[model samples]
Target: MFSASRGFVPLLAAAALTGVLLGACQPQGAEAPPAATAGGPVRILSAKGLNPQAGEASPQGRLLIGRGKDYTPLNEDPKALFDKLEGSMAERRKTGWAIVEALLEPQKLTLDGKTYDVPLWHTWYEGMSANPEVDQKIKLFIAQLAACKADADCHKSRAEIAHEVMAQSGTDKNLVRSLVSANLTQVLKQSEGFDRGNPEDELGQGFTLFSPSFVEHVLAQAQGIETCSNKIPWNQAPPSAGQFSPCVEEFPRSAVMVKTNWDQIDGASPKVSAHATDAAAVTAVLKGGTWPKPTLEPVDPSGIYTVQTTDGKLFGLKSIHISTKDTREWIWITLWWSPKPDEDFGQDRPASLARFNGGVWSHYKMCVTTAFNETDPKPWGSYETAQPALAAAIKASYDGAVEQRNPAPYDKVTTWCSNPNLEHHTGNGRTNCIGCHQYSLTWNELKERPAYFSDTYAASMAAEYPQYGRARRRANFPAEFAWSFGMEFQEQIKTAREDQGFSW
Candidate 1:
């Protein structure tokens, strides 16, 4: 009976195994798996009240893992937000004149008794409209804070109060000043790393704090300075009084007009000769009236020519012009009598005239061409191409002159015209074509401030050349060629004077 029971057991086990395999291969009716919740906690449908999903250890139940009902979203504290806004306002103020003007509107505040109108103010305000909810919240906060009766009340909710203040017109003087100062400080800090240390380098800081024009205007107002004239209070002065001379013998009272064709002038550049031939040519090129043949005005060889103007002040004649091609372009003509011999008086006169006409007048034409070409639709085909070509032509002419001379060994030359302190050591290193003639400040100054070239070349060049469109926008020219010769000349003079035991 026991053996029979064992056989039956084996048969039953085999049959169960076969049934299990068949069941595994057969398809059973099954429910589809649940889909994933987008950016939300996963949930299992099979859990209940002890709510394992709510517990950190539960994986098979609904979990509120992020900012859902069980989790609260973090809020930026009012104080921190207000502080950030204040910082932003200040940064915008330093960037440009426009922002400063907007910040200093009449209703808001004034600096140095002047109010600037910044167009950017409206644009900034309008930008806030893009976020109506935040804008409304800011507006409400501001209204409540402004309505507060005391500082104690304002401090009750400091962050709310600050938000209100920033959203409003910013009329409080102390607040406005603090904001401005803070913005400037931030700009100064960020600007430390800039190699150039110019205003453009801090543009981002400026825009964040204030608009461009407003920043410039406010800074100017703060400094109590004017950008146009650059004249300070201490610099204003009247013309000097004329010196009187007693009548003397030996010196003739007669004056003779010196005239030479621009082409005949020894120092005149070929570029100059191409445009102007004589005084008339110069006047025509400059759009000034033709200069008449000069007749010397008589003077008491010793007594300078004095004119009693209608204003009743007797002033010595500095110079007078007989005529000009265009009266509009005529600046002024002044003649100075030579205190020394007449021969010594005219030593540099011809060269000076040619320099003035070629360097100044031709430069003006180049500038006009540049401006027109920049604005023209067909600029490349127009005068635009002419500028670089002309510059090249001028450069070639200068090179021709230097090449014609006998080559001086670099070691034989005591000093380079550009850097007199640095001596050339090798005979092989001859000064190139550009090195000799590229130090022309007259031409550089014209490029810097075309409008002011005729009236104030030196001053304009000093102010604008370092930050001019070309210098600021394009790659910097090589220092060897771009620096003014005046500096080199001054250095040479200083060295010579020191060698002679004289103070510069």
Candidate 2:
């Protein structure tokens, strides 16, 4: 069974965001103006996203060069610099920004005899189940499981089972490795897992997309390990189960995952606070079922990246959580739509973003983290240097929470990067992207449901949170710092086992 406490804090307690529905007769061409922003005039860059006909690998290569001489040019070999995963926090921040720029760059796609320009990442990724190869892989694994169960003394290793399956089945390894990914489905719970439909009170829809490289790495590991079983060698160390392949200089795109939170926009209102639910309200919010019923009708498209699903539904991007295996611990970055785009996390956003595609994306704010502990050196990337107000805001928020309970110490040294929309559960203001993710482990290792606040603070000056803190004081193997392995893969295998009529 999957771990009961998936390490998520909880959803925001705020009331659901509401919208004023427009008249049903409005023409599609009569698009409303983009939401007003402190960054200046809104630009309508392109009408592109999610082409149903285009496959995962359809749109490849960079679209635009990043601005400024220091930034790596995306049009060139951007991954070359990204692979560096430099030691210093400042350099890692720059690399993180460069990667985000590449992801946001528009790519061209044609649908129904018309051209649409969408962000490269949107065109390049799909839901994990969307890949046809995964089902085949699951079947092969199930066969291996049944064979082992039937034999009295079956001592075959995962490698042996994989070899046998490949030889007999002639499995196409490359096809499995080339697929894109998906399945986060809530307002702000993108990282939690796939298709967790919104519970009442949660506002928007969330999607977590994986690049081909990320899928390839996970598939390679699944092919080599028995993820569904609780009998994996528990004593094995770092390179064993749960640990993902590293992002090295040789393989730059080892693993790249993005989680985006979106709200349905009503073109008549175009308010950030508004949602498309008002037009075609959900008849009921399923507790543990599929997305709410009574499909939300499409509102007229406004400014910002908006997509019209094949079902004629519409969604507007609000926030994004991006974690790339750029560094050993990975670079944690988040961007969210804000009326005051130039303040806090959005401070120091390059002018190139404003100029690119007529500044359509200038309304989003960004923050990145490379190190577990925040040590601010002047003239570099720090909440203080890059965004002092953000640092103060985080501290203030933490202080308010601390009055109610004994929360972790809030100070300048606490590295912070919390998406307000996504990370609202518990003391989310005090939580960094690396904190909860560090607890990502296999089902066997996490069966105990270790203390969430055990290793929140640094153990000492020498070690970071993952190695030295109380939470990870015990020897454990991580599922590559990715919660999806347990939440998605194990769940999929569980379903597959049921399909094979195999009881746990």
TM-scores, all candidates, are 0.14, 0.56
lDDT by residue (tens digit), candidate 2, 1-504: 101221211011000000001112212332331322234432232212223344323321111111111112234233444343323444555566677876765443322232233354543333343333444555676667677867899987654664465444331121112211222234333333322244543543565666545544443356232343323343344443333332112113346767777665645655443211110111111111112322233322333445433222445667778877655566788877766666654565765665333344666767676554544433233555556654444344333322322223322343445565565332233345775575544322333443233223323311334322212222333555666655566566667677777653
| CA deviation > 4 Å runs, candidate 2 | 1-92, 110-116, 128-200, 223-253, 273-303, 355-358, 377-412, 442-477, 494-504
RMSD to the true structure for each prediction, in A, is: 37.1, 13.9
In model 1, state the lDDT of residue 281: 28
Model 2 residue 228 CA deviation (Å) reads 7.0
Q: What value of lDDT does candidate 1 attain over all alpha carbons?
A: 0.20
Tell me the whole-model lDDT of each prediction, alpha carbons only: 0.20, 0.43
Q: Write the per-residue lDDT of candidate 1 for residues 1-504, one digit (tens) a residue.
A: 111111111110111111211112311222212222333332111111212212223322121111101111113342343333223311111121121222222221122232111111212211111111223333343344345533453444534454344445432111111112122123221122434333322111211222222222222121111111211111222122211111101111111111001101112221111111222322231122112222223222113322121111222222211101011111011122322212211221322221210111111111011000011212112212423432332233223223323222211111111000010111101222122212222223335431221222122342432211111111111111211112222233234334434321
Best by lDDT: 2
